[model samples]
Target: DTAVSQTPKYLVTQMGNDKSIKCEQNLGHDTMYWYKQDSKKFLKIMFSYNNKELIINETVPNRFSPKSPDKAHLNLHINSLELGDSAVYFCASSPGGAGYNEQFFGPGTRLTVL
Candidate 1:
């Protein structure tokens, strides 16, 4: 069984469009997170949630919104997508939380803005 999964593995859109990425985890972990992997292969944390409360919000643009409906789901909604938004978005789950526990990442969602 897939421990962590994301929808629409590939996303292609034009600039100024809006998009969303859905993430789900079956690991029964206490915390879940969202990260953006740049072309340089650098992973940057975008958001983190524990017990349905947002714990981390990075210095990303306000167009990016992270929503957690529950402990098992983390969905990212982007408004007015820009070219800079093109990257691989990953969802991860940390057993205890995003603090120091190992994070299991879901297959990334590739976003391309034209």
Candidate 2:
């Protein structure tokens, strides 16, 4: 069984289109996160949810949104997708909020915008 899973492992679309990626975890974790890995291989956290409450990272743009209906799932929605938004998005989960546990990442969703 997969500990963490993301649907539609690859996404290809044109600029200005909107897209969404779904993620689910069966680890019984309390905290989940959305991270983006850029072309330069820089990984950055976009959003985090603890028990369904959201905490957005300060540097992330408003075009990115993360919603969690429950503790085991976190879904990412991107509006007005831009060229810069093309990257590998990863879903992760931890037992508790920041600094308490190691995050287990999903297979990742690669988004390509033309």
Candidate 3:
């Protein structure tokens, strides 16, 4: 019944590791986004998809990729995670690709890289 959902709410891994976070939305939204909130609580957009096309991609580590096979899903894959990669990864979705649209976020998946 959730609008958006992510698996493995907490991820704890060592440095130089790899991880994947799965995200799914049942709201039938066409635009989905992956956001990272650092320790300072400042959220930044990592990637966004609209109709399976990457609409917005912000500056982030090349090891981080947001893969979306469909409109209702966006899965994050991190390779060789570093300590700087530790943050709360959030999955969000909106009706449109515009950033101004009201976004629905799922319970974040906290990634802690030691």
lDDT top scorer = 1
TM-score of 3: 0.96
RMSD (Å) per prediction: 0.8, 0.9, 0.9
Q: TM-score of predicted model 2?
A: 0.96
Candidate with maximal TM-score: 1
Stretches of candidate 3 off by over 4 Å are none
Give the range of the ten consecutive residues with the poorest summed lDDT in model 3: 92-101
- Candidate 2 off by > 4 Å: none
> Pairs clashing in candidate 3?
none
Clash count list over all predictions: 0, 0, 0
Across 8-64, the per-residue lDDT of candidate 3 in tens digits comes to: 899999999999999999999999999999999999989989988998889887899
Winner on lDDT between 1 and 2 is: 1
Residue 95 in candidate 2, Cα distance off native in Å: 0.4
For each candidate in the order shown, give its overall lDDT on alpha carbons: 0.93, 0.92, 0.92
TM-score list, all predictions: 0.97, 0.96, 0.96
lDDT value, candidate 1, whole model: 0.93
The per-residue C-alpha lDDT of model 3 at residue 5 equals 99
How far does residue 67 in candidate 1 sit from its true spot (Å)? 0.6
Using lDDT, rank the candidates from best to worst: 1, 3, 2
lDDT of 1 by residue, 7-95 (tens): 98999999999999999999998899999999999999999999789899999899999999999999999999999999999999998
